[model samples]
Target: MTISQAESHKHLIRTKVWSQLRKVALPDSRFHHDYSSFIADFEGSSAATDLLVSLPAYKNADLLFIAPDNCIQALRYRALKDGKTVLVTTYGIRRGFWILDPNEIHESKWEMASMLDGMERIGRHIALAEITKLPMDIGLMVTGTGAINYKGLRFGKGHGFFDLEWAILYTIGKVNKKTKTIAVVHECQVLDEELRGEVWDTGCDFVVTNKKIIEVEDASKPNCGILWDKLEEGMLEDIEPLRELRSMKK
Candidate 1:
């Protein structure tokens, strides 16, 4: 498909998923509606998060970099309660990292650390240099795909935060071949169609929903490091963490 065709296809898929999710009525969920899309923070988010933590890879992973998304809160909370270290990034890595170390947090406060704002309140603010110094394991990434094929080909929101976050970890040698990447979304988001992503994009090892988990066999994950040349103007100046990482490369 041409670039325009691809965009139209993605918009259609994303719109369908968002519309369906909005129609869902759940007392347990808190919806965030703004811009052209909406994020329904469904009760199933907990169910899906539970499914992810139950994975053997989740148990084995010592450190994880989880997205600070509303849907991903459960994973962050569970990881901390289980004594695993979590690294959370602000929107686009603009605000750097919040290190959620179970050992450092009081047991009662694990729930607080899971919330997007709570991490900044209670967790340690980790510099890019400090985080790059440690080893990271499996990443329990938050997925916001409009649709994805069974092979785990994912097309997410237009923003490329997840891709850039993975690049930073991979570049620092923190994430290695052993690392497993996973994303949990609603079952409706799983599509039979192959919606493609850019060259710098990475596919998940597993696509999990509250109902079941699908292992992606096709390896479309990006092999090289960050796509520095492809970044939008002033990206290096705007995101502090990326800037720190770039200076290290120099």
Candidate 2:
């Protein structure tokens, strides 16, 4: 199938950004830029993390749906320290999710709860069945957009896992238009060119860069829940957690 103009442009931008960052010899040596991930070399991560934590959504949320990203590790730790319940996906939502309760974690192990390996050690794993039952609060979604225009259209590594995550939550009535979704990115990722976005794509309600927080006004977001017809076969098998949710829904 031929790619759309927007997708084509997104690819170009990805290549350009990845190459340029590599030339500069980033602080982190593990550099890899794939179709759906721009991780491991972001420069403005520290400032972005601060900006994200400062948001009211982060401060006030009782239950937070946070993405598993190294850039947002501090946010996770801070949330836990603040006595918030945090829900994070397990590597592509394959193993489902991990729920971290501040009271459950030892004060000394709060750092461990935020790290990937430490998450399994300190947090409780929750399958789709249990996760679907919770009333979600704000979400801190991690995005790897090589380029995003002012319109708030985001381009992922191309796999659309972020969208799928949101769809799953939406299908269970866990989120809605009022849900506060935030993304922390570098100023460079904010581009000038517009990209065509699909309705299923979960656009950010608030964008936090190293410099400031940009509230995306009248942002175009998903109109409905997950469109199961658009899914390929064996999806449930691939994402093990979905298998349970599908069965429960039936």
Candidate 3:
């Protein structure tokens, strides 16, 4: 983690740009109200349905979880109750601070303990390794974001966990072309414009909001190959959870 490496970190720059853009209210957010209405309109939309129940195709998935928001709620509650295993990532607020929830489905609030326990109740409990590494032990991974380009992801503002999670999974030999990852957001989150992306961000295979199950084209996936040679040493350290995980792995 030399100073030179820090100066050249593209992810940091992308994060800064995203933070700036997020305040502008991109065109995608315009659909937030409409998308939310659609979710309420459809009888079988993912979010409005039982959070725990599995659909036909997504049934076999090892993991199926959604981010908690005004748009899509975590379905793990219904999943665990239906006797299925689920995984969830808790929100981070401060230094080395993470709220781990196991059975987050049961608890109404979004925090670490409830989310972790709920996931554990159905099966293994996992979270995005941070904005640095991906989960290797789990078969499925899930997340949500503010907006998604046609390829299925946009820079996550200042939160680096999404990309970091994918990179770490690649390091541990977990994610690949075949890996199934999904993002759930309100329909307003889908973007048609190309979001300037760095070589480190991990794109999603599927984007699900309240209205539809969007299967993005493969060519749109950013950072398809691991840039192991491009591993910015200090950049990883800049993201605290990654540093901790690396230490534990050591």
Q: Candidate 2: where is the Cα deviation over 4 Å?
A: 1-4, 21-38, 135-144, 232-234
Give the distance in Å from residue 68's predicted Cα in candidate 3 to where it truly belongs.
Answer: 6.8
Per-prediction TM-score: 0.89, 0.86, 0.55
Query: Which residue window of length 10 is worst by lDDT in model 1?
Result: 26-35
Residue-wise C-alpha lDDT for candidate 2, range 1-250, written one tens digit per residue: 2347766777787666556544432343233444244344366767777888787777767888877765577778878888888888766677777989888888899889887778988999987667766666445454444445677776556666777887877776666777777776667666676666776878887777778888888776685666777655666678865676678688
What is the RMSD of candidate 1?
A: 2.7
Residues 205-226 of candidate 1 have per-residue lDDT tens digits of: 8887868878877646776778
Candidate 1 stretches greater than 4 Å from native: 25-31, 35-40, 135-146
lDDT rank order: 1, 2, 3
Tens digits of per-residue lDDT for model 3, 1-250: 4544543453454444344434432223324423211221122335634331343435665444343332233454444444444444433311332223334334443333224333233333343354234332344556655456668765343444556556555555555546666765555556665554556666677776566677777733344433534655565656554565566567
Lowest summed lDDT across 10 adjacent residues in model 3 is found at: 34-43
Model 3 vs. true fold: TM: 0.55
Summing lDDT over every window of 10 consecutive residues in candidate 2, give the lowest-scoring window.
24-33
**lDDT value for candidate 2?**
0.70
